[model samples]
Target: MRIGLYPGTFDPVTHGHLDIIRRSCALVDRLVIGVAINRSKGPMFSLEERVAMLEPICAQMSQDTGCQVIVHPFENLLIQCAADVGASIIVRGLRAVADFEYEYQMVGMNRALDDSIETVFLMAEARHQAIASKLVKEIARLGGDVSKFVTPEIEAKLKDKLASS
Candidate 1:
């Protein structure tokens, strides 16, 4: 089986992400959506909460797409996580020129870590190209409607976090 790893901060998975996940599923036998740990941006939800939020969304997609999906809160090195999971390829969603610049370097670094590992970049569907988890959270935090950008569960989680703060 061709295992593919899709790693991201996922503070809360957005529709744009789901879109890529949906498409990527068709290209690979199995896709592992790794919730990568990043201390710099500081996630809105705890790691546990982050994993929980991914469950339903992932399940729904897997059921509909016939793709096996796993969501894991990966706390160590991204390349290590992929290797541990036996993923031969890393699936990434590229939205714009800005994203390309960042991912280009990341792909190179990942290749250095494991030359056998390859990175596949998929362009976001047009409507979702501008949507990002940070952008969704920012709008949701400011009381802007993000119902369109994220799943219902993520929306509720974001709303709850914003309310508590």
Candidate 2:
């Protein structure tokens, strides 16, 4: 089976992330959503919360897409995580030139680390090209409407989390 790894902080999964997930599912036999432990970025949700939020959504997506989706948490090296999960390919979404530059460098590094691992880049759909989780959180924190960017469940959770903080 062609196993692909889609790794991200997913502080809160946005439509953009889901778009990539949807596209990646069609390309690989099995897709694993690797949630990174990135405390340095100061995510809006805890690691546990992020994983919890993704589980049900991934499960439903797997049912809908017929692509087995698994959410797993990882720390430190991403290349190691991919190896651990037996992922032969790393799937990434590119939104713009900035994304391309960054991801291009990472792809090179990942190749150096694991010669057998290949990287695939999927361009974000036009509607979601500008939607990023960081920006979504920022907009939501300032009371801006993010209903269009994230799911209702995530929107509610983001609003509540921001309101309490």
Candidate 3:
């Protein structure tokens, strides 16, 4: 089976992330959405909380697309995580040329590490091109409405998190 790996910090999965997930699902038999344990940037949500938040959303996506979407957590290198899950392709979303340049370097490094695995870059839809998790969190921290940038569920969670913080 063609398993694709979509790894991200997913501090809070935004609509742009979901867009890539949906599109990636169409290209693979199964898509593993790996939530990286990134403590350096200090994520708003815990790894478990992030997985909990993604569980239902991935289930819904799986049901909607007739493909399996597995949410997994990884603390190791992305290539190692992909190998652990038997992923032949790594799906990444590019929002702009800047994203491409960054991803290109990473893709080359990943290829050098494991030539068996290939990276696929998907362009973010125009509407979601500007929707990044960091910016979304910043906007929410500043009391800005992010309903247009995320699902209602995610928007509610962001609001709840901001309110308590």
Candidate 4:
């Protein structure tokens, strides 16, 4: 089966992420959403919280698309995480030219490490192109509406998280 890995911090999975996840189902039989445990970034949500949030959404996507979708949390190198998940393709969502510059370097480094695994870039839909998790969190923290960037469920979670924090 063709398995693909899409790695991200997913502090709070945004609509942009869902867009990529939905589209990625067409390219692979199994899509593994790799939730990275990068402490350096100091994510708003815990690793477990992030995984919890993605599970239900992924399950729904799998059911809808007939493609197996699973969330895997990883603290190791992204390339190593891909191998662990048996992914031959690493799917990445591109929002703009700025994202490409960073992703380009990552693709090159990943290729140098494992030439067998290929990286595929999917452009975010125009509407979602501007929706980023960081921006979503920022807007939420400042008491702004984030309904446009996240699902209603996620929006509630964000509000709850912010209220508690």
Candidate 5:
């Protein structure tokens, strides 16, 4: 019954995100990929599109890793989602000191909000340390190929989105 929450905007679920999802799969019985509605950033895709993108990715992850991965969109404080799911852990992927600095503070805040919940930090694979959704969107917007960053499915969605936008 050990469940964990992985909350993020997931603007476009990249391989970097998948890497963390893959690694965390081994340690928990279930992992909820929380597609948070982040009002702070302009999203390239809509919430529905993001959820659509995550559905297949999560299904594939479960099939490949034998770990149950489900995607949920939460508009409230992240701790509420964790509480609703009865998850006592928050899984975060740390890529560098800069990443750690922000995540550390957020982790502390989440812990303070819910003392029963603990945040688990997972280091991103060395190669993916610099790859982020912002970077991917920037590359695509500037007509640079980002095939290696996101899945083929995500790439197509991005292409279609960019083409129309």
Candidate 6:
């Protein structure tokens, strides 16, 4: 089976991420959403919380797309995480030229480490191109509406999280 790994912090999965996830199903039989445990970033959500949020959504996507979707949390190198999941392709979502500049360097480094695994970039839909988890969190924290960037379920979770924090 062709398995692909899409790695990200996913502090709060945004619509932009769902767009990429939905599109990625077409390229691989199994799509592994790698939730990175990057402590350096100080994510708004805990690793477990992030995984919890993605599990249900991924399950629904799998049912809708007929592609197996699973969530895997990783604290190691992204390339290594891909290998662990038996992924030959690493899927990435590109929003703009700025994202490409960083991703380009990452691709080069990943290739240097493991030339066998290839990286695939999917451009976010125009409407979702501007939606980012960071921005979503910022807007939510400031008491702004984030319904446009996240699902209603996620919006509720964000509100609850912010209210408690």
- After TM-score superposition, the amount by which residue 128's alpha carbon in candidate 5 deviates from its true location, in angstroms, is 0.8
Cα lDDT for residue 146, candidate 5: 93
Instruction: List TM-scores for all candidates, in order.
Output: 0.96, 0.98, 0.98, 0.99, 0.97, 0.99
Model 4 stretches with alpha carbons more than 4 Å out: none
- lDDT to native, each model: 0.89, 0.93, 0.93, 0.97, 0.91, 0.97
How do the residues 57-79 of candidate 5 rate in per-residue lDDT, one tens digit apiece? 89989999888999999999899
Which residue pairs does candidate 2 place in steric collision? Answer: none
- Which of candidates 4 and 5 is the stronger one according to lDDT? 4
Candidate 6, residue 2: Cα displacement in angstroms equals: 0.3
Kindly list the per-residue Cα lDDT of model 6 for residues 1-165, writing each as its tens digit: 999999999989999999999999999999999999999999999999999999999999999999999999999999999999999999999999999999999999999999999999999999999998999999999999999999999999999998898
Q: Candidate 1 residues 1-165, lDDT tens each?
A: 999999998888888899999999998888999998787779888888888888888888889989998897788888999998999989999999999999999988888888999999999999999998888888997899998998777788898888888
Compared with the true structure, model 3 gives a TM-score of: 0.98
| Local distance difference test, candidate 2 | 0.93
Candidate 2, which ten residues in sequence have the lowest lDDT sum?
Answer: 156-165
List of clashing residue pairs for candidate 6:
none
Better of 1 and 2 by lDDT: 2
- Superposed model 3: Cα runs more than 4 Å off: none
Clash number for each model: 0, 0, 0, 0, 0, 0
Candidate 5 regions off by >4 Å? none
Give the CA lDDT, 0 to 100, for residue 5 in model 5.
93
Measured with C-alpha atoms, the lDDT of residue 97 in candidate 5 is: 98
TM-score of 4: 0.99
Q: Mind sharing the TM-score for model 2?
A: 0.98
Q: How accurate is candidate 6 locally (lDDT)?
A: 0.97
